[model samples]
Target: MRPHTLALLLLLLATPAATRLASAACAGEKFPAGRAYAACEDLPKLGASLHWTYDAAKSSLSVAFVAAPAAAGGWVAWGLNPTGEGMAGAQALVALAGSGSGSAAPTVRTYNITGYVPLGNVSTPLDFPATDLAADAAAGGRIRVYGTLQLREGMRAVNQVWQVGASSTAGAPDKHAFQPDNLGAKSKLVLAGKSPAAASPSPAPAPHASGGGAASSKSPNAAAAAAGVAAPVALVLALVGFLATV
Candidate 1:
């Protein structure tokens, strides 16, 4: 066989196993010492994950939101939407790396998003009560936002929105990308019952400048299907690299 042909065959044979390993790594995620939760789920978008425990009696929720920013000095946010399912009307906790100063640690802040504007500038109160908000860097360059929220009475499930941005400005979260994964980042989070509940997609308001203000909803399957396409494209790129070398 030609050198490039042999390389292409090897890459094709390895792609499935590599994909499986990547999926398994997310599935078997482990928390740092002293950070434990009742359940966790690998979210379908943005390569994010959530570990949470809900207290039914106290109507409290403890959550650790985990995701990597799009680049260094970027930010990540995870939030709950009490009034709606999309980014608008959601209570978000944003994490940004701290500047290099004395005792300059990572920080997490709360943002009550009223619209699809830039999140860094909007620092308002959420609809519900939240406390113990903190952020820190984790292994693999991922940022973790840890907080406990006091939900309304009888809120068994919640609409969740998560995002990762390319950069932040002056300790504020910048706007995240509008890629398919970013747009499809919102989902339904079940607080109780069996673990790893199937995610239900929510209808987000049409993003600003995407024409006019309307409802733009994404199917859960569409995100999953788009995620699957990435692996094949990556394999093809690797094949092309091998061919160039040959």
Candidate 2:
């Protein structure tokens, strides 16, 4: 193949990887309905997945949880640790199958945690199922629950946990199925929109004499540096292509 053609082919082959890296770094990340955030899915022994996004301007935090439906019909609970610790002092949202006219829809209740007990009736009608959860129920299955909550001052960071339980009937006694039970293992909820630190300008390198001998072409450092430079160039090219398509 002609040298120019070979170079063009190599550039084209690098474009996809570059585009993915660029998107991951700078594009707005979205949490898909009914799925765990990719960053939290790998937590050890995690049975349920939670995803959250915070809108600082609106002072709101939207959270979603996804877990397999209990075979015998039960409840799924997500809790927040105001102190960033254990189940104690946690605020939980519990979703259970409803009864009577709203039986088809799941009902959500809020509780303030103390030890193993859920105290107080903080349950409000604000919590509801996501569209995917509704669709799943319509198709004879249930898998997801989502809702938005007002973020109080200094609530930007907190510990979070999930639990699943078996309940014979709606509002019946619940049998715990899964709970992390360890504050150390609980996941964290971090709000978005924090400003990143500005980078200090790097000093320009001293210029070498033009008549000096060229550096060794086979040097490992030289090759590595060249590879690093090429990667960003490829990313820029891929980003340009993506913007053009948009």
Candidate 3:
């Protein structure tokens, strides 16, 4: 066999192996949803607390994050929280899809993501099911997709990102032991518009009742007002009178 032909055959045989490895460390399970992998810290820091905002109106989850470039000890890949027991195959994908007519232009290399881990462990890396995007949705699954980035170091001896649905965050020696990796380019994440968790309802007052203060003594009606009620009985009487007439 010609040398080039042998090389081609070897590459072809390794394609599936390569693809499977991309999923994650096998734990007889799958990755998580609503999570992402990136090689940058700035991205995760952009959206402070409550990175996930639930849109009760649409009955959908909206994630807001800024795609930041990779820094030292940046995030490598993302997967289901190995700790997220029972539901691993759940996944999601959040990318900075820019305005483009087609896949012809040099697209923006944003700190987007592939899937998530049910349990939260952001120290190690996971898989990116580039092919299984729809499998989850078809199975009535959901994901909390976050924007992320990742780059491979081509090492597989220890600390392999083993994502076994809802199991331990371990992997083959090749994965369990991740070599020092780096991303040597500027990657940016823009703050895209986020959807409201509810009907964008007015900000409800924080649950800040202070030992039954003046605000607490107020009543639904002055008839039951406990002195702390502002504008007291007259206000209540008018409301009750209006209701009676109606």
Clash totals for all models, in order?
0, 0, 38
Instruction: Write one digit per residue (lDDT tens) for candidate 1, span 1-246.
Output: 587788766676566544443453343555554445545567889989886656666777777798998987788999999788899999988888766651355678888889977656546787777776777887777888877787888887789999998788877777778989999999888764433332222223222231211222333443453355466767767876867786
TM per candidate comes to 0.67, 0.50, 0.20
- In the order shown, the candidates' Cα RMSDs to the true structure are 12.7, 17.0, 26.7
Q: Which stretches of candidate 1 lie over 4 Å from their true place?
A: 1-27, 101-104, 198-246
The C-alpha lDDT values of all candidates are 0.70, 0.47, 0.24
Q: Report the C-alpha lDDT of model 2 over 204-244, residue by residue, as the tens digit.
A: 11212321111111223323433654677766667556656
For model 2, give the 10-residue run with minimal summed lDDT.
195-204
- Full-model lDDT, candidate 3: 0.24
Worst 10 residues of 3 by lDDT: 155-164
